[model samples]
Target chain A: MKKERENWVDMAPDALLGYAVVVLALVCFMILLAIVVAGVRILTGMGAA
Target chain B: MWHRLTLEDVKVIGHYLGVLVLVSAIGLVPPLLVAVVFGEWHAASRYLLTSGIFLIAGSGLRFLRVQPGRLSRQQALAITGLAWLVLAFFAAIPLSMSGHYANYVDALFEAVSGLTTTGASVVQDLDHLSYADNMWRFMMHLMGGLGLIVVALSFGLFGKGSASLFTSEGRSEHVVPNVVQTTQFIGRITLAFIALSTTIVTTLCLVKGMEPARAFLQSLWVSISAFATAGFVPMSQNIMYYHSLAIECVLMVVMLLGSINFTLHAEILRGRIKTFFEDTEVRITAVWLIAIVMVFAASLAASRLMSDLPAMERRGLFMVVAAYSTTGFQNVTTSQITGSFASGMLIIAILMAVGGSAGSTAGGIKINRLAILGKSIVATLKETLAPDTARITISYQHIGRRPVTPDIVREATTVLILYGTTYIAGALVGIASGYDASQAIFESVAMASNGGITSGIVVPGMAWHLELFYLLEMWAGRLEFVTLLALMIQLVVSATPSSLAMRLHARRAQRRRS
Candidate 1:
């Protein structure tokens, strides 16, 4: 299992770049959304009081 | 020795281009009528003058007595690339004359944007622009989304060059065996959808409290924009100006249908409903859309940006679909999108980069190419894992199930790399011109993929060189790089001293033969 995982990890950079481009974008969006949502909630709570 | 273009090549290209220009002149008539009805005399006269110029130029070109043989692939590519640039120049005339744009370049930018179905506009205060001008802008969308060559062919323009011309316009599949018939079929499908969408949107606009005439016009414009996935809006605020769920829903459906493969539409029209679910491209697009929406929705919910489920669905889901379809329609302002959805901008850019399916109005890397790449990866893994003597085969349904060949994988990878490199190059240009990396990437992908969604970076007076770069990007993106590259190479080769001398010899030979 470990050997197989290592083999997959050693895939060509060109091949990996395509997947990385998509995954990185998705991750960035998710994290940003979380932070934005928290800030919006905090602002709204303060306004309500 | 490399084959060089003769005077015959020049005449042949001229002849076809002249025919296209003549046909394009007819496109001006509708806008003229709109201007007359709306009493916009200034806009009306501009259309008349522009149309007249095109008519004369087209007639002169047709006067070139060129014998017809099928256009070589190189000539077809040159004609296709040259035609868009020429059309953009002519289209810019009326746009610039309207005095709404800062200069000719700004108008040309909008013209290229419209004709490429990119939907990015440099027009300031669109709400105050003349109705005729607005009509002309969306008219470019309608013509360009169908493809200028497809439009010309639909008018019975080509003889033997029809197939090459059709394919050269970035369409990979035909709905029918005959090119003319295929174009006609595409035209019919588009008009039918336009009628249906216009009716639905008109009714929705009426319900949303717009006046009858304005509602109908707005409905027509939005319907055409949505169906082209071209995203031009008559109003400054775009779809958000209406603030109606029903309108957004209708536009969303239109965008999805517009982005679908035209071949699939033909199949469905023939009652092959199973193909929709079975086709690899369609299935992949559906899966991608759903996954993107889920992530987008989660992000929206977590960010508390919209405050409720309905708001999240309306704003979040719609933006995702818009980007995924490569339709630039927005229910939010540019600043709101850039500021509020800052983190999610990368997501939208990625969606834009992936774009819609092949043989559709929408542009991008295309779902078909991505699906092929995915399948290729799996095949590679299977080959690696299996015994040395064992042969593995992979297949997916397009028109029908076909085994994936090495050539198919190579072609798919080449296009993917081209798209990636172009996307990066455009982003680099944006960053060099003083945009932040994220904003640069977002706007670059939007321009390169014909997505038209902006991160507030593109404006009328920002920088001339950047606008020029984007103009080229939109042109290159719309032609899918191959035709443009072929056109460039053909120009370079034809302009060489040896090639020019060879052309002169060919002309002498032709004269002697005659």
Candidate 2:
């Protein structure tokens, strides 16, 4: 059985969707950022070494 | 009949397309003038032909039969979708005709990039190009940056259906009672600033190191790019080409200002500027810039990427603002950046996807939409804690409204859906084109957000299919995706399925009745 549909009448109509889109896009972005962070960590480590 | 963009409320979408073409045609003049100054008659002549053709076609369509009635809601979506395609096609012809651009799709892609104020360039070498070509490329940012419809309405007014035309272009605010007047205000303010900015920045650059002539030219291009939030640098090496941190800092300041609404700028200029600080877009964007930079800085700190906190903080913050604003300017090369730097850049990709304030030259989901979403999230969280009898309210000011509405939320959500789906779908296609996952994803975000920067996905003189994909992505990005999807849905619905089904079903019902 399906859950009751939330009344978006009181909610910001675009917020959920906007959040979702941003999150999805952010995930991809964050992954790239993590990789950069790791690489920088390694490079700086080697430099000091 | 449709007139050019006028009336804050009453015109159809078709008129916006017509207005953009007409405005782009008119905008071609300055570049043509520049071409004359530089002695490139061939470039000037080709541009003249292109502009002439665009004007005739646009004006002709503007005069087409438009009944004085409520425009179909679908027309707004249709016009937005078709406008980019139409502009790209006509705009490309001149560049190709001038013999610089080899492929029509490349022409289309560059034009799309220019008009969307996306800074992506398929062109590799810029050193040999004549002044006219360079100016023309820069002018695309100017026209796209300020919005052609707003530009047209500033110089001219349309009767009756003006409001529809304005709404079709997705304008919600009215700075004046009449949109034409508002357009004039915006243009006057913009032109004044452009003059001041160009003069000051050019002199400063000249004082520092650049040749006077080159500085002047760069100033003109940077002024347009800054105002439009477009990331185009006249030189091939981008902002880094100058190797001047001062210039980058100056350009970044302008780009940030450009990302905010002109109305906000006006408010600040008028000295009633507290409104500017209070703006949801402004505050959120500030927070976003700070938060993203901190996260990356922390990530770098953990990884020990850059030894100095102040230096990493400055570069990280700069990249954050640059990406989020969709200006795509960077003083650093892809080669020098680490994987952490790539992450920081990707964060910028997400920020670009979020874009700038609405009713402005900047593109993406915009800060207000995010603001509204933030409120909604708070409201959701509060519902669990509040008593059943508690009367609660949520409010935020947009262009003019004090309390954001459910309708606004719905519209913003629909646009987000369109933007998200397009980014992912484009990435999938790029992957299909044999690009790596990271490159495909990065290019997808870049193209879909109208953020021009890629991780080697876009090669110089690319294949036609890939060029077409980028062109379409840029167009859809400029319109925020839903408008394009709405147009496609209209066509698909009109051509084959539902109409045929309805007709056949009606016949069966009639036979049953008989």
Which runs of model 2 end up more than 4 angstroms from their true locations?
A1-49, B1-20, B59-72, B301-314, B337-340, B397-401, B497-514
Give lDDT: candidate 2, residue B308: 54
Writing each residue's lDDT as its tens digit, candidate 2 over B131-188 gives 7877888888876776655666677645444565456565667676787877776776
lDDT of 1 by residue, B350-395 (tens): 9999999899999999998888889989989999999999999999
lDDT of 1 at B47: 94
Q: Model 1, chain B: what is the TM-score?
A: 0.96
Tens digits of lDDT, candidate 2, A11-44: 3344344333433433444445444544554555
Task: Tell me the docking grade of candidate 1.
Answer: incorrect
Q: Pairs clashing in candidate 1?
A: A37-B303
- Could you tell me which 10 consecutive residues in candidate 1 chain B have the lowest summed lDDT? B295-304
Cα RMSD to the true fold for all candidates: 10.8, 10.6
Stretches of model 1 off by over 4 angstroms after superposition:
A1-49, B1-3, B497-514
